[model samples]
Target: MSIFRNLSSRAKEDELMDDFSMGGAELSEALVHLRRLNKIFAAPGPTRYGVEKLWRMMGSPASLSVLDVGAGSGDVNRKLLEWADSRGVELHIILVDLTEEACQEAAALFKDEPRIQVQRADVRDLPDASADIVTGSQFVHHFDGDELVDIVSHMLRASRYGVVINDIHRHQVSYTAVWLTTRLISRNRYIRHDGPLSVAKGFTARDWKELKRRLNHETMTFSWKPLFRYAVVIPHPLKPGGKESGIGYA
Candidate 1:
């Protein structure tokens, strides 16, 4: 089968960054380049859109806590903090990743920022209703099948308000763009190999639809965003008393 054909199905190949033990200078360099690429593509746009939508639905709380799963380098959360600051809202963000190196990098990046915390753990292990909002950026594409469903289910359970997933939209155009852009901007082997592979591992609207079907979440919505991205937003249901069904904030 030709690589360009069958773009409807998600590619199952593992990315170079899939290895949680990866670290050192090369990993560090690749992360820097990935952060730069995210900025160029406005990768945080979809995430912010989902988050703001949920926030507004929650009546624009003065303070919010966000838990970001598979938060590589935590660059996206940094952008979220900036957005919250601009809007005069306080945001306490928790950055979770399976890799120690990623946690270290995130720690260093937010060393002076008291509002951010980096934790090395799986999202599934987190306590229920630990955060007001749960988000994943360029993260969910790493898994498929039952694992993907379980992870997303846990994210929904872990949040009191909603879940926001911002990830690449698998398409030939996105794949080509990432393939060429990585080659032009990064000499790191990992970036060059995984950039396009990430696009290949991306999802489509049908994929999200299937995932929602599996989870049986009727309110979940998946929408296309700029630069070939998908924002999957799921707002938690409210109780009859006009409060969220989850535990109240302290």
Candidate 2:
């Protein structure tokens, strides 16, 4: 085995890459650029744990509008809706993605549902869009320095309740997992390169802290999961443990 197999997860998968990032194909498995995207929509170890934890922690999801800025292949959106259905939480979703290709793909997943709408749009800057909950999974790791700051700022400004950003944790272990997982699980070239590259470029908890400082520490909560190799919840301030306090981290 390689030394990467022995490194911390944070270091391994943070820089993984997929086909989209590598320009290997026009389309492929959602997991190609789907590093963090999977857990948002589906359920598994850390990803499921994070979403479920936030659901119980928040206590009320009867009225929540969710915005997935970089809605890739509708993975996150589907998972959010599926969560609502299973938990009895009623949610409205606004799905925005950078490419229409993603829109076409996402549309298939949510085509029958009127509550979910996929739009070809950019989420780099969160507009005047107000949502009770703002969530992005595995998506934000695509940024570097100033771009990351700008994206987070835009997200913070738009959320009235809170935000949940499920993203890769920057580290060596994370890089390795991304590489191995892609190699073992996917055959798409785009997913392979972009997957590991994404891991290499991931962010750590410290980065989010810096974002909080720059954004006035507006009542947020942060959790980093080791297994999933990503940040689970970074929430906005509200009455702690209050059922209807309108505070949530998804």
Candidate 3:
């Protein structure tokens, strides 16, 4: 258990050798494992909750556009779409990832999903206010410091409604639990290494407070969710009063 708390601090680690770029049957299998992990742990639920918050804020718009940053395999986007559909809300999802392979995979997965589009692009380079809301799940932990600021800023800027980021919470219990669970159910080397690594790279509540202070954005809201996940939501800037209003915090 002590070994699971090996990281010096909440600082980001170097990017793991993610299997999404391996470009073969191996990548496909790795992605399958990744999707399974997200499903088993219900990683996308908090992101959907964030979207629900934004939807209510928008006066329950008939349609919404969401940009999912670092949308590996776009599983989160798929779940979000399903959630909106159940509520009779039309959803258009844009899946963005740095790896072309990831984009291609998402595109293929959602080809039947006429409302979904996939793009390979850097978050920093995305144009401003491109979607109704920008969402990411298990994504922000991959960046730190200036890069984290840039990503969050870009997500907020791209969302006409808001930004929702769902990521792990860095804690010894969180890390140890994921470490044990992944080892038991997953044989993918990437999952075994990156799962715990992701947890370790995740932020503490204190870290989120400091990050919000540094960003100096008045509209941003952060809360801890079930399953040791953090939900960070930044409401639309055009909203009256310019503060996160009415949305319930977890």
Model number with the top lDDT: 1
Give the Cα error of residue 69 in candidate 2, in Å: 1.2
- Candidate 2 local Cα displacement, residue 73, angstroms: 0.8
Q: Candidate 1, which segments miss by more than 4 Å at Cα?
A: 1-6, 238-250
- Candidate 1: Cα lDDT at 223: 98
Ranking by lDDT: 1, 3, 2
Writing each residue's lDDT as its tens digit, candidate 1 over 1-250 gives 1235456688888988997567678988888899999988999999988998888777788999999999988887767887898888989999999887788888998899999999999998999999999999999999999999998989988998889999999999988888888988999988988888888889988899999999888778899999999999988866678875553332
Q: Give the runs in model 2 whose Cα sits over 4 Å from its true position.
A: 1-25, 28-61, 124-126, 232-250
lDDT of 1: 0.87
Q: Candidates 2 and 3: which is better by TM-score? A: 3
Tens digit per residue, CA lDDT, model 3, 62-118: 988899988988887777878887999988889998876677778778888889888
lDDT of 3 at 125: 87
Clashing pairs in 1: none
Could you tell me how far off, in angstroms, the CA of residue 222 lies in candidate 1 after the best superposition?
A: 1.2
Decoy 2 TM-score against native:
0.73
Task: Give the worst 10-residue stretch by lDDT in candidate 1.
Answer: 241-250
Q: What is the lDDT of residue 187 in candidate 1?
A: 93
lDDT tens digits, residue span 78-175, model 2: 55566778778777777777765677767876788888877776665556646765667666777656766677767756766556677766677666
